[model samples]
Target: MNPFDPTVHLPDELLERIRERAPIHDRDNTFPEQDLEELRAAGYLSILVPAARGGAGLSLAQAAILQQRLASAAPATALAINMHLVWTGVAKVFSDRGVPGLEFVQDGAVAGEVFAFGISEAGNDLVLFGSDTEAAPTADGGYAFTGTKIFTSLAPVWTKLGLHGLDTTSPDAPKLVFAFVERTDAITTSDDWDTLGMRATQSRTTRLNGAVADAAHVVRRIDAGPGPDPIVFGIFSVFEILLASVYTGIARRAIDLAVHAASSRRSKKTGAAYSQDPDIRWRIADMGLAYDALPPQIAALARDVDERVDNGARWFVLLSGVKHRAITMAKHVVDQAMLVGGGGSYFSSNELSRLYRDVLAGAFHPSDPESAHATAASAWLGPLES
Candidate 1:
């Protein structure tokens, strides 16, 4: 089995194509069709699939590195790609169980079909907790999922969807199942993703009224587990790191632009270059310092994950801390980049603007800064008796 290598990842050519299409994608707030096509062609969409199942057998750490590299070129493309990779990881978790609806997920991955998470719902303040969507068990032993899922990121191009919910009628239903649904079976609404940043993600609304899902499509229930699976935990940790990495990439790009602009642009009064100014140099230095601190912190977290998996320890607190630290660092880096880049960074033409917006998205994700901090603090306070 070939191990996934971020350094040797061959998606550079594909990423270059995404970069070419980014401006148009952003301008129109449309999905990066070209980018998705290239990713599918380059086998990037299935990078998380197991080796036996024809995937690249990449580790979470490697995936994080690759995401950062890709994000440097295009954050929206990286976001869409990340969603696909996450869904693929989810599919791998169910692969061994011979889950019904999930076979199509594997099939879609092999066939270059994209996947997205349909978690966020309309009028739901809390994405995870307040899902209005109901999964009712039918007489036929299948489930009928009827609800609207808003912010369905990457839905326009995704071939499959990962649906998360509980039995609405039975609020205390002991199990929570993450269902893998075929996109064709669900009704999709267009252009619902109107945001200040990451507009190119094409995260629209999906109406899944009466969508059918069977035992095969419905994977394992949450209560079926005794301990957290290392692979699943590792993958979740990777997502946190990847979120930071994408912002780190954006920050780096902003620094590069700032450097180039400072070196070339001269001060009118002093006849000195901006790069030669003490203030500009200090700001740039601050950006560099922030960027430098991220990799080591995130790498440390990834190493901790690897160590825990190796030692067979369940450390949910560690994962929470990693997510909290990485996201905080990402915010700091992006903020510093904006400060160093100055007013010109406000323009859409400036990559810094996009990076700024992309970094903001991290602050709002499910494992957001506030929740992560609370989780870590609670863990430090001591475990509560169940």
Candidate 2:
């Protein structure tokens, strides 16, 4: 009955340890330093790297399964670690596609270096397609990034930042340059991550005032937003799937807790458990019904990615669709769980309450509801009247 029963190499005890610390980190608004450390010790950071590269050599589907399990224990921790996995997963995608670039990413993961995703910028609805940051080319062919990156997860201890910027000074003009910048004096993490629910992510704002990436680390220079480039496809495909997995895990945890609460909480008038009530049972069944479609969908897409199955132009729609569904289902299931949990679930301290808050974050992630709808519509019905 446990969806997290898939043992994808993540130890049960390690998960429990992380789960035990989730509340404290959430309450104190601190990064899960110890959780990260334990994960590192477990070799979790390198799950996507090839075995030859000193990693577990797990496929994207396997990693997704593990991520879902991790999220169930600690959603914030799962989300924070998602940034690191994004880079590693990207590296795996490149390797599979025979792209020479991003091997350094795999190597770094094997070395236990934490890589954070820095693609987000204020007013940049394009996600990976556009960047507000300036990628000033250094005389030596590297880049000096100057701009503000919002929602930079793993802020407290990221060793390298995987980000992109606009190269306006180049002959091409406005090409998005991808590279990695090591943590340095030029990079500053703003103390401004006070948030609802997934507070433990500590995805603080990072101001890169001439944060430098050497020429060697500069990987791609491509046109941004909806391209056939492997780099773009790799990042988008891996990111959305893993992100969906995390939220799916949160949904699972919420339903499990609701089941326990519904069974134990008694109705004063009836002198019986609330679980006996048909409405409460129906709510739980509805939650399960919404949840039933997600895991298989996530797994199938992830496997398709790993197997190099081409969905043609349908890739974006498919990827975004599953992500959208997973998050929406998660939010719906959590809402149902709260209703079934009765008034006690209203308090912030309740686990169900935390799940309620955490699930709200799904709407804000990339390829949000509007974007997902647009993407899917474009795929099925063609573009709207110009």
TM-score of 2: 0.97
Candidate 1 local lDDT, 1-386, one digit each (tens):
66555646545666677777887788788888877776777778777676766777665566667887888788888877777777665555445334344556666787787778777776555444434677777676556678888767786777667776556454557444567677555565666688877888877888987777776677544542334643345346555666666766666676777788788888898999988999989888887776787767666665554343443332545555555655566667677667666788888877777777776776666566666765667666755568
Query: How much is the lDDT of residue 342 in candidate 1?
Result: 71
* Residue 377 lDDT (model 1): 71
All candidates' lDDT scores?
A: 0.68, 0.92
Give the RMSD in angstroms, all C-alphas superposed, for model 2.
2.1
- For model 2, residues 147-248, the per-residue Cα lDDT tens digits are 999999999999999999999998888799999999999999999999887999999999999999998899899986668888799889999999999999
List candidate 2 segments past 4 Å from native: 1-8
Q: For residue 92, what is the lDDT in candidate 2?
A: 94
Looking at model 1, the pairs that clash are 100-216, 100-217, 101-216, 101-217
Top lDDT prediction, candidate number: 2
**lDDT of candidate 2 at residue 139, scale 0 to 100:** 97
